[model samples]
Target: MLNYSFPLTAAIVATFFAAGLVKGVTGMGLPTVAMGVLGSLLSPLAAAALLLVPSFVTNVWQLLAGPQFGMLIRRLWPMMLTIVLGTVFGSMLLTGGRTELTTVALGVALVIYATYTLLAKPLGVSPRWEPWLSPVIGLVTGLVTGATGVFVIPAVPYIQSLDLDQDDLVQALGLSFTVSTIALAIGLVWHGAAPVGNLLTSTLAVISALLGMAAGQVMRTWISPQLFRRLFLIFLLLLGLEMALHGLLRT
Candidate 1:
């Protein structure tokens, strides 16, 4: 569908598998990992298209797997709605010709979030602030997602501030990412960034991603998740830096 060569298609499949493996091991980072890798070669819009199915399917499972879905829905619905609104209003940045800008934006987003993850102390949000702050964060996160195809800046931190238990936290991420993915997919479709033929390719990528997740589950028994997560973040930081610098130089 993308008209890439055999080797490139193989590489994309491998990329998806690896991304899904990270999600299986870390319970997050599939889109982050995949977009950081794919964005270097493809337009952010194309990478976003390729990411839709795997991200949605996996996150849906993650969202449903936890015990607090109904409660989270009640609590986070406003943020979710705002993410959609922001995505629709901002999708033009992604679908337009400013490929380098989007790539740079994607790279910067990765660096900021990864650094925050590795260095930032845990933060808390007052319950009094959630009513107003959550929607604002969602709007910004959605705009960033619409412009750059990455969605883990204020959104992730906002979710963390809620101080959820480990299980609920994971499920919350799933819901957040699922909303982002669905909204992004709609934007892409609305602008013809994802053509009908691309669905076949995206669906195939889902298989590779699931297989990678299975492999990761097996590997999870052999090593420490904390170690893997640390290593993964460092890798992401470096990749983001390289991508950003490359974008800057090209401009």
Candidate 2:
């Protein structure tokens, strides 16, 4: 696993900045990007630790800045609560000696998410079904998050199923991601993977992430979002393929 000799290594900053840049453009994917870039050099737990602050800060802002804050909370509280529970329950897999398992899980998650996004048709859920279905999705999403430090798979897809406008969907994503970050933080601490000891490096990562977000925002204006999304999914598919292969071959 990678270790830090300096408080603020350029590698950490650059990795997070690149991750933040992706989230800035796409409105999601900080953890996915950060995990992919850093997981090779460090264990997944250590990489996840470095991303905690950036993910939390950014997602909190995304959550609060939305017009649907109160309404979304009321609608999503059940799912959110279940997500927390699921994380704690699933923390059993966040142990120190399971790097290969986590790596394989991470790769599988990326592949699933990218493939779903690219090829899956739009799905819709009725208002009546939301009462029961929401919690189920939350639990499953949380378990996957606990296992792999990446928390987008079913959660993002489920959130997309809700018939929300663009802004509302973005806010919903922020809400889900914020909860996942907190849950992952707790799970990491429970497993002794928390970056509490590396306070300076983690703090600096937040700054780098924010800077990358700013650049991505600028780039967003210059490019077609549809095109960018397509390109991003393709990149993820390839990245996930390589990761999965590497882990399986190593094992």
Candidate 3:
């Protein structure tokens, strides 16, 4: 078994707090921030597992927040299908021997994706792209999410690029995360990674995440969307770089 010290525990608490705040305010970012922080202190697999409970909880909150069940059901089917397939594929490859390689690959791809989103301008696509393109984004996001826990960053740009209004965007982010979180949890279970022993740590992390989400919601009214997006992007880039270095050097 792995040893978790008090200081590390404290750090994990803080991370969850921040992650929850981001998710509550922006309608996403919990898994992204939580995994990034936990990835630094724990094995990448553990970090990935840490996100399961919190994501499940918050995604449910997002799903029930508004009366968009019909819209979500309509648009989410394709993405859900893709994630189901991706999860099966990811489950087959997970093992102790592959952990380091998987972590490194996830870190590298996340860095590239984060850079692209941060640097590139939004594409002016027609409505035709919505059904066709969104699933592709979902497929890629699911594949990464199945392999690691860092799928949200890449997934964010695809949704943000759509030019959805604030309400639509919020609802979309909430639903996207909700579905993805469920998919990821199922994948982890299929892969035998959801042992009961993880419950204690995951519970603590979820509490912290809730606390953070509350804080973020309060702060959201004060910060503009543009600033929030930029801030999140910067945070993601830094975390990606840090993960890359850690994965390459330590593993």
Candidate 4:
């Protein structure tokens, strides 16, 4: 069992709080932000374990906030199933003493996600292509999530491209995130990385995240969405660079 000093506990709370604030303002990024910060101090799998419960609860709230739950689930089932399977396979590898590779992979994933956020315009996908593309994206995203515990790259962008109404889009993201979180949790447990004792700390993280989310909700009305997004992307870019450098140098 790992020991948690006062400073470590404080850092974890602060990190999750900030991550949740970003999620509240942007409708995404809790895992991304949490992983980026926590990965610096802990192994990728450990960081992932810490985030499981908080991500699940918040996403559940987001998922239930809209009315198209059944519709979205039906349309996205193939992708969801593929995500789960891919995550299982990837988790097996991650738990097999591949921490260094997983850290590098997380860094690369973050850089790619940040680059896309900075450069990509809003894309629209034709309905005709959804059947062919959704499963592929889901599989890739699941693999990435299983290895690195970050699930927002290809999945988030693909969902955004669907051009659903704002409510549906939010709900879709929530559904995807909720599923991904649960799947990741299961993966962690399967790998023996997530123990029952972690649940207490995870619950504390949930509270901090919720408080931060409430504060961010108030700030959302004051901040312009475009500006907030740009700032968010910039932060991710810096964090990604740091993680990549650290991982490379350490290796």
| Candidate 3 per-residue C-alpha lDDT over 133-217 given as tens digits, one digit per residue, 9 for 90 to 100 | 7677778877777777666645677777767777777777777777777777787777788766565678667777888888888
Tell me each candidate's TM-score. Answer: 0.96, 0.94, 0.88, 0.96
Which is the better candidate, 3 or 4, if ranked by lDDT?
A: 4
lDDT of 4 by residue, 1-251 (tens): 23588889899999999988998898888999999888877888878888988999999999999999999999999889888887877787556676777788888888899999789898989999999899999899899889888898799999999989999999999999988988888888887878766766887799988988887888899998778878988887887888888778777
- What is the clash count for each candidate, in the order shown? 0, 0, 4, 0
> Which window of ten consecutive residues has the lowest lDDT sum in model 2?
1-10
Which tens-of-lDDT digit does each residue in 1-251 have in candidate 2?
13575533767778788888888898988888887767766677777777788889989988898998999999999999888888767766755567787777778888999999999999999999999999999999888888777889799989999999999999999999999999988887776767555544676678889998888888899988788888888888888887788877777
**Model 2, position 32: C-alpha lDDT score:** 84
Model 4 segments beyond 4 Å from truth?
none
Q: How many Å off is the CA of 180 in candidate 2?
A: 0.5
**Order by lDDT, highest first:** 1, 4, 2, 3
- Write one digit per residue (lDDT tens) for candidate 1, span 1-251: 35778887988999999998998898888899889998987887888888889899988988999999999999999999999989877788989978888888889988998899999998999999999999999999999888878878789888989989999999999999999999999888888888766677888899899998888888899989989998999988998899888889888
Candidate number that wins on TM-score, 2 or 4: 4
Off by over 4 Å in 2: 1-8
Predicted candidate 1, C-alpha RMSD = 1.3
Worst lDDT 10-window in candidate 1: 195-204
